[model samples]
Target: MIRKINRIFQDYMREKRLKIGKNIWDRKNKEKIIEDNNFIEDNNIKSILFLRYDGKIGDMVINTIMFREIKKSYPEIKIGVVTRGGAKDIISNNKNVDKIYEYNKKTSEVKKLAREIALEKYDLLIDFSEMLRVNQMMFINMCKAKINIGINKKDWNLFEVSLKSIDYHYHISNLYLEILKFLGIKNIVRKYDLFPTNYMIEKLNLKNKKYVVFNPYAASKHRSFNLENMIKISEIILEKNFDKLILIGTKNHLSELERIKKRFGDKIIIPETENILEVVELISKANLVVTPDTSIVHIAATFERKMLCIYRREIGKEDKNSILWGPNYDQARVIYVDEKVKNGEEIDINKIKIEKLKEKIDEI
Candidate 1:
């Protein structure tokens, strides 16, 4: 199949890249992070900028969570974020972010954006993207900020404050929190927040119902569950008196959504929109969420909704919090599946043990 071939090719490229030592991270620079975090906190920063270039969903969630905690600690501080163009909508209404700066990912615009960033006069800068050393270096050198902080793989002298070098194997959230800790903000809570306006909730018209939501797609091929397995899960859930099933994802996932529709017909609801707030509002009304490791999972967690989080076994092992981090009031259960197959390699959906998932859902 085309999917199999694509996966094989991707695996081959990854292996080849690894063979050339392209994936290795520097180990020596891990100690500097602690020193940098300390320096930033001691200075009492008033304005801060968070820079993350690889603006994927998970990365955006991590940044949003960190920004929220930072705002809680330093209520007077103004926090802004700089990310690639498409991510502005994701954090547009986030209370923690006072502003957002969009930068083109291409090299040609880097210098121009760098200049714009330098003009901000931030008191502190936090760089979340690991490979953007050149970008961080430009910001540190050009920006008027007194303190520059971020994770570094190498001893990049560009940052005024940098964390101790770390292995790439760590969970992204913990790494992000470690950056915050390095800045003297201890007791950082690991909760994610997504605020959907009343108007947005009204638009979705999601009333009280024992509905289950499904997010069957992931941006990464390695992380997405099998579409067939997802369909089967939908069928099984519908059979269990959870008749209302909502499928959530971006426009790119329409085809996958259609596939589920063919399987479930009118039983599944596909809410299509570019707005994340709309999606958050939709998930807020659901009784339970079944999703791959994606932003919607975190959003559901914010709403204190019970979640059935599906994750690649490797990622699940790396961060226990991947399955557990949710709103304080709700319980979340994580289901770990191997990375080799899309969705547990055609496991029997009827036989799939979801007692834990059901228990969590019933708890609330």
Candidate 2:
């Protein structure tokens, strides 16, 4: 009941704010002239700032991939990124990013951070955050960048250069690359390039096992897999001749890990730690990784580890090139669980086909 009410309230606020934002944008568009590609090239940008406010795992992955291509075009350019604290670990080691700025979404730190950004004197600012949040709009307007590029949303007139997608059906990596294309960056390369440290790899002692890692938790309940399904999947992995199974997440997932362990004691390894780099190192050594659509999956992609990614139907819209986003450098496969109903009721675990899952496991 509480979840239903929260969803209703959230939808109401979204619609209300979107209406107001559209009206503001319409008024602004009538007065300002939209610039063209010629104007962008004339600006001569030397430094670029990328912003990812939504801070989802996919968005960070797209950002990291796009930044690599952007760096290749302008090797001498300085690139910076601003994201939430949760994504700090993913973006911290990104080669294209010279500096990383983190901000709390709930506090005034966003505004304070924006102020500092306004003083950076950047040549271009790219807002990869698709949402039209008021604070982000304010920050984009304040930045000293000569060329500002972003999505052509209802409030797109506020940006000097913009690219519009047909709908939300487009892949996020392509969407980000579209903005780069608008800025005259044409040599596009789509691949995940995250380099893990030797220190991180050494700490996990990952060389000894033919193992697969599983991360069944997500920040939002709506995106998480049912614990029962997670347990069944773990059991299938153990039965399929795998040596070990590592479960990684925060302490909140300990109960679920314990539940899995109870069924297959000592075979399931759940390491408790607040350090994300350690988790990355552990994931790097895995022979295969089974995870929900989360940041850990992005880390696994960096190491080119074979992956069995289970994505919810609703969130699957964001995964445009499903196979491309998988372990691109090595063996990987993506299994999308479409909406399935049983006995006139929406069943969560039933959405994933166990037989198809086993077939994919056998292929890997």
Candidate 3:
């Protein structure tokens, strides 16, 4: 099958890239590999830079705790973040971040950004990349910070303070906080903070009407609820304790959302908006948030909004996805489609029971 061939090709490319990366890193930093965990412990840090170039909104939302807590604990330490795309938007309003450097996958751009970072001469640099890709290693090596910290990997001799990987299942946000814990930042608060924008404030005008946000789409189709199930869920929510149902998704989902819009007409409210922050603002003020496995879950968790999330897991098997990246806030409920799935197959989220979903809506 095409999928199997693509997987094989991807694996081949990954191994090839890893071999090339190790060769390049060995030649580039032959005499620069240092291991000193005590450098940060001895109060010798003044400035810190974090590499968060992965452009997922949920991942960036989780990283918010790092920026805020570090600034809170060490008021004098200058904080800088390297990010791109939508990930940049999440922290654009963060007060704790003193500077942000943007970079992309292009070698020229990354090299230029690395040179710029080296000029800053940060006392500490942190790389949270679990996979030590060639470009990531190239950028990290080029940064030339005094002390580099990151999650430990087996044979990669890149970071100076390589903290051991977290062994137990914890919310990813808390797992990231372990880096701060290693740096002696004890006054950590396990919560998320999002700044309100004038654009978001001006755009949201529900006028005190109670509304629930229903996001039935995900980045991948398999993770999204099917149209039939979406309608059923919408009907269930509307019949329960909500005044209006606000349907939301990205521009790519407009046609499908429009189709759903035709079914309910005036009862369903779809706000015209631009950008993810607007969607975040929409979730912020909602009465309750209902979504599939998507970044909306994280946005809802940020505000501790009452949330009902849907996901799929193989029956009688340990669901690692839910265990690692489920909603972190209280007042959150998740409905998992527990059915047997064969190997190399994606679980169908539409298989979730409508009765169970309705039960959750009533409880919320």
Candidate 4:
């Protein structure tokens, strides 16, 4: 299949890039390297840059905790982040982030950013990219920081102080916490930081109305709900005696959402949102959130809102996503549509039946 071929090709390229990095960095930097995080304080590090070029909103949400905890521990340190794919909006108004660099994946743009960061002469650079991407590795090599720290999933010469391999038994957010623990941060609290505006509240006139947020779209088809299935689930929730059903999606989903809106009439309110922050404001005030596997799961978790999530897994394979990135709050409920999936195959969330959803809604 094309997906399998792409994976093989990507692995081959990653290995090739790693080899080139070893050759380039091994010869370029011959100075003594420290293996611990003491270099942060010993060198009197003032400015710290974090590389989060993966750019998924959920990953950015998870890293928000690191920005807050790091600032709490080192109040005088200046924090900077390099993010791509418009994920900069997640941390746009964050008080802990002093600077944010946007990478557009263009060679000229990246080189320009490198020059700009080099001029700042940052003291520390931290990379939480769990895997080696050629672009991220190249960017890390270009930044002129006094010290570099990165996750050591595989052997690489780029980092002076490499953190240990990620432990899959725990939540993925803990990896960011591990980075903080390495820097001697204590009493760390595992949570997400997202601030929303009052514009959405005022415009929707939802001062104190009870509502449930239904997000049926994700970045991938395998995780998104089809129109028919979404309708069935929506009807079930509407029968639960709630004030309203607020449907959410991107512009690409507008046509489908409009069809559902027409079917439900005034019962469904699909508010036009300017950005992801408006969506955050909407979710923060929701009585409950129902979503497929997506970043919304983490957003609802950030507010510790009552949520029900639909997830999928291979029949016989280990469910890595549920273990690592599942709901972080204790009050959340998740339903997996694995019974219909073939062994070792990706789960199609649309296959989840209406009866199963109704059961969960009633229980909640």
lDDT of 3 by residue, 43-102 (tens): 478999988888778888888888888888778889999998887887787898899888
Q: Is candidate 1 or candidate 4 better by TM-score?
A: 4
Candidate 3 deviation (Cα RMSD): 2.6
Error of 3 at 281 (Å): 1.4
Candidate 1 lDDT, 120-143, residue by residue in tens:
778777765555434444544555
Cα error, candidate 4, residue 77 (Å) = 0.8
Q: lDDT per model, in order?
A: 0.64, 0.69, 0.80, 0.82
Whole-model lDDT, model 2 = 0.69
RMSD of 4: 2.4
TM-score of each: 0.74, 0.81, 0.92, 0.92
Worst 10 residues of 3 by lDDT: 26-35
Top candidate by lDDT? 4
RMSD of each: 6.3, 4.4, 2.6, 2.4
Candidate 2 lDDT, 91-151, residue by residue in tens: 6776788988886674377668877887887877777555766656666665555566666
Candidates sorted by TM-score, descending order? 4, 3, 2, 1
Error of 2 at 178 (Å): 2.6
- Report the CA-based lDDT of candidate 4 relative to the real structure: 0.82
